[model samples]
Each structure stands twice: as structure tokens, then as C-alpha cells.
Target: MTGSFAVTKHAEGAGVIRLAVRGEIDDEVSDALAGIVANAAAQPGVTALVIDLEKVRFLAAAGISALLEGRAATLQHGCSYQVVNARGVVHGVLATTGLLSLFQTTIRRTAAHR
Candidate 1:
């Protein structure tokens, strides 16, 4: 069900940032997601920003917009971006919207991220 939305930022390595998202990504949390991504991607020396959606249960229009926004910000900052662990409805929405290719989906979680 409707779990409270949250985004947790973790520095996975020297130039990589991992944002682990939990719960639903809807209108209520889209802005926060965009802001976090923008900020992370803007960080000096950050070369990659990974969004881990393993715990995301729902994906809405606003969420997709936020994701697109995040991708733009990452690109603007010259940082690579990717989405991982999305499944079920979340995965379906991304694929249907043609964002699955945009985000460069890497569904499997690496041991280092766990």
C-alpha cells in the first residue's frame, strides 16, 4: 500500500551518488525528488547519479516528469544517470513512456549497492 515516500542519498564511491527511493512517487513527492537529483548531480566531482527504485511501489505522471527533470539536471552537470530495480507497475510505466531506454535501466542491483 501507500507507504510514506522517502529518498535516501548515499555516496557509493568517489564520484558516484546513489539515491535510494522508497514508497510511492506521486505529485506530493515529485518536487522533492527533482530537487534531490538536481542537487546531487550538481555536486563537484560527481560523475554519476544512480537512482535505486527497488522500494518504489507506485509511479505516477508527476513521478515521470520528475525523473525526466532529474535526467536533464544530471546531463546539464555532465554526470551520468541511470535507474535501477524498478519492477511491476513502476517498470511498466517507464517502459511504456519510453523512459526505460532513456534512464538506461540496469534492473539488477550490484553487490556493492546492497
Candidate 2:
């Protein structure tokens, strides 16, 4: 797993908040992810929260937990939740944990495809 990690928030359209996550999502950075998602969901006028994992190279158990927490927070706030660009290890982890079916997902073209 890479040492670097970042989650950048972007406001898209009227009521959509997109969080683009980069690098490894391990124990060290899981809490930050949860907090960011919760905050984004709690914001006024936010109708949906989108988490982008295109650049995520790894996802630990804690990271999965964080994603679940984010989903809960979004639901509690009456907002829709979605996860996008989950590929490679990140995609496998979510699928094996049965979380892939829990959230809405859309296929994204990777750099190689683009």
C-alpha cells in the first residue's frame, strides 16, 4: 500500500457532493474518511454523496468500516449515497465484504481506457 492518502471534496451540480479519494485507505486514514463523508452528508442542500475510489490502491477493514459509517451518515441525513471508480484491490475488498451491493455504483473508464 502506498503511504500517501487524500480525500478531496467537490461540489457537483445542485445537490451532489463528490469525494475523490486517493492512495491507500488503511487504519491511519479511515477516520478522516468517515469524518469527511459525514460532514459532507450533513451539509445543507446536499442531496447526494459520491465517493470516488479511482486512485485507491488498497482498502483495509477499517476503511470498509469507514465507508459503511459514511453510508449510514448519509442515510440519516436523508441523502443518497454512491461509490464510484472502485477498481483493483479496492473493488475486490468491497465485493468480498458484500458491500458492493449496498451502495449504488457506476462504472468509470480508467486512464488506460481513456
Candidate 3:
């Protein structure tokens, strides 16, 4: 509701880590996001990292910074990274900042067709 945040890791493909982020991402969780992404990227057999923000309701500037930092870390580690499911305000912020290219952006579609 107010300031809740959570990150859950899910395995993807042969070497990928998908982090599903939920709740508001403000100053408090921004640092945590960076740390989590860095650690996950550094883990063995992790060649790709995905930050799914479909459930994220509110994303502040700090959160944007974290995503940028996380992308840098992934590139530094030679690991592919992408942030998906960014819609509404999150999409606007990322688009306005020209980060859509940095992190291959994609929306999470509901299960209806295909």
C-alpha cells in the first residue's frame, strides 16, 4: 500500500535471473535494488538479468538511478540485462530519460491471446 517493497528471484533459461519487483520504489528500496542486481549478476551461471517491474506502482528518481546503476553493473560483468513490464508512470519516466534503449524494454501481457 504505502511503502511496501519486495523482490523475488526466479530462474530463467540456462543462465538468467529474473527479479520480480512489487510495490513502491523510493529512496529506501533503490539501493537495495542495485545491490540485489549486482549480486545476482555476479552469481555463477548467470549470463542474463531481468528486472520485472510490472507490479511496481510508484517509481521515484532514486529507483530510476538504481536501474541505471544495475544496467551498468550488468554490462561491466558482461551479463545481458533488461527491465520489462514498465507501464504508465514508469514507462514515461524511462522513456523521458532515454533509457528505453539501455534496457530492452517490454510490457508484460496478460494471458488472453497467445
Candidate 4:
């Protein structure tokens, strides 16, 4: 319950960074997430950051704060940030915090071609 989650990064477009997150995002993973976002922001030509949370099972307050901070950093660097495919408890946290509308979220469906 206190273990760290894994986050993977991928380049979607010319200036977009897509991050896929798996497992729980609590206090234990907040620092790691912050670091990951920082690193992504540091990349040259990254104009947008998108976090895919389809596989995320849990997200705590610390995780939410980290994401908000990341968004601020992205904005300061002239970049946009978003979170996608949030469900269950993760969706509840964002909705309750009024952050659901703050981010550009998209629903993802499994692809049969995969």
C-alpha cells in the first residue's frame, strides 16, 4: 500500500509529452511524479504534457498537489498540461477538488488493433 508507482513517458507529437502511469499514486509516489514532470518539462520543444491515468488505481492528496505544481511549471514554461482516462477514486479526487475542469481530459478506449 506504500509502494511507489511506475510512470512511463512517450513523445506523442512535435511538442507533446505523454506520460503513462500505473499503480497507486500516494505520498510514496508523489516525489517521483514531481521529478518525472520536472524532467519532462526540461526536455527541449516540449510544449504540452499529458498524463494517462487509465491504469492508476489510487491517487492521494499529495499526488494531486504534485500534478497541480506540474501544471504550474508547465504553464511557466509556455506549455499546456492535461490528465486523461481517470476513473474510480482518481476521478472522484479530481472532481471534488474542482480540478476536473482545470485539465484537458480525454477518455481512452482499448484498441483492437493492439
Candidate 5:
């Protein structure tokens, strides 16, 4: 693999838990991500979950499956789920897989200096 995946968790909003994922998400890393998603949903007051895939370099089939499972887990928990901040290759994978419309995604913007 050209890259490794790492996950970090943060409370981005009231009742929202954001799981920020970095690097490649192939077979080796997808399972771990599912666990994170499940844990986030089980947290008290977490009515919504967002998986930030902005930094993901590669997303394979396993990764996509994990995300789908995460969405299902959220629904089972009576919470809302979304995947945001995906760009380039990551975004393309989601689009081609027809998953882009399944979850809510927003482009993250950075400040520009003139």
C-alpha cells in the first residue's frame, strides 16, 4: 500500500460526532472504521454522525462497505448519518459507486490569502 489510514474522533457540534479519517482505506483498514462508527453511535447524545473523508487517499470496496454499514448503524440507533469533506479520488469513488447520494457530503473550504 502506498499509504496508511488513521482515524481521529472529535465532537464537532451539539449531538454530532465527527470521525476524521486520513490516508488510504483499503481492506486492511475498513474493519477498524466500522467499529469506530458503531462506537460513535452508541455514545449518549450523539444524534448525528459525520465521517470526514477529506484526507482519504484511496478507497476500495471494503472501505465503501464499511461506510454503508456505518450508515445503517446510525439509522438503527435512531440517529442521522453523513459523510462529508471528500474530494478528488475519494469523491469519485463515492460518486461512481452511487454512494454519493446515499450520504450527505459537503466540501470543506480553506481560507485563501491574496
Candidate 6:
């Protein structure tokens, strides 16, 4: 089934890029998400990348891999990376994959309630 997703970027001053993502994050959306993060990581002055996943409903392995790849790309460019607002199944997947501690995560209520 086709999934829906959206990515909105907010430049936080000279070195931070905050990307807010919503909806399903699966194989269909991983490539696009990776592209966004990669482009931001490649920016000359960007030193930090924050991926906000509070509104995400599902995250497949492809999506997790994309995040890991983005983290590596950011680090290579001397930038820090963080994934926030992961909860429920998303959180479980990350944790089960032993990536929970690898990325910064913030547990928050789902967007539907807010």
C-alpha cells in the first residue's frame, strides 16, 4: 500500500537543521527522507541534524537504515544527529535493533492527541 509522509526543514541558526517528519515512514519514503537529510548534512555551515518523528505512525527497517545512514553522513561532516519523538512501535523497533541508544530519542505523546 502507498504510504504518506512529509518532511519540513527548519534551519536553526548557523549550524542546526531541524527536520520535522510526519506520517508513515517505510521503504517507499526512506529514499526521499535520506535525500533531505543528506542534502542538509552537506550544507557548509550545518553542524547538527534533528529529526522530529513525533507524528510518525510507522517506521520500517528501511527508514531506520536511512536514519543510521544520515547519522553517519552528518558525523562525517562534523555534525551531530538526533532523532526525537519516537514512541510505541517505532520506539520498540529501534530498541530491538539495539539502536535506541545510538540516536538521541525523546518520548512524547502521539500527534493525534495534540
Give per-model TM-scores. 0.92, 0.90, 0.90, 0.89, 0.89, 0.86
User: Which tens-of-lDDT digit does each residue in 30-99 have in candidate 2?
Assistant: 9889999999999999999989999899999999989999999999999999999899888988888888
Give lDDT per model, in order: 0.92, 0.89, 0.87, 0.84, 0.86, 0.84
User: What local lDDT score does residue 4 receive in model 3, on the 0 to 100 scale?
Assistant: 72
Instruction: Assess candidate 4 and give its lDDT.
Output: 0.84
The lowest-lDDT stretch of 10 consecutive residues in candidate 4 is: 105-114
Model 1: lowest-lDDT 10 consecutive positions: 105-114
Best by lDDT: 1
Task: Compose the digit string of candidate 1's lDDT tens values, residues 47-97.
Answer: 999999998999999999999999999999999999999999999999899
TM-score winner between candidates 5 and 6 = 5
Highest TM-score: which candidate?
A: 1
Backbone clashes in model 1, listed as residue pairs: none
Off by over 4 Å in 3: 109-114
Candidate 4 lDDT by residue in tens digits, 12-70:
77898888899898888888888788789878999999988888999899999888877
lDDT of 3 by residue, 25-62 (tens): 88988999899999999898899998998889888999
Off by over 4 Å in 1: 1-3, 112-114
| Candidate 5 residue 9 C-alpha distance from true site, Å | 0.6
Clashing pairs in 6: none
lDDT of 2: 0.89
lDDT of 6 by residue, 1-114 (tens): 535689988886868788889888888988888888988999988889989887788899899988988888888888999888887888888888988779977664434447
Clashing pairs in 3: none
Model 2 residue pairs with clashes: none
TM-score of 1: 0.92
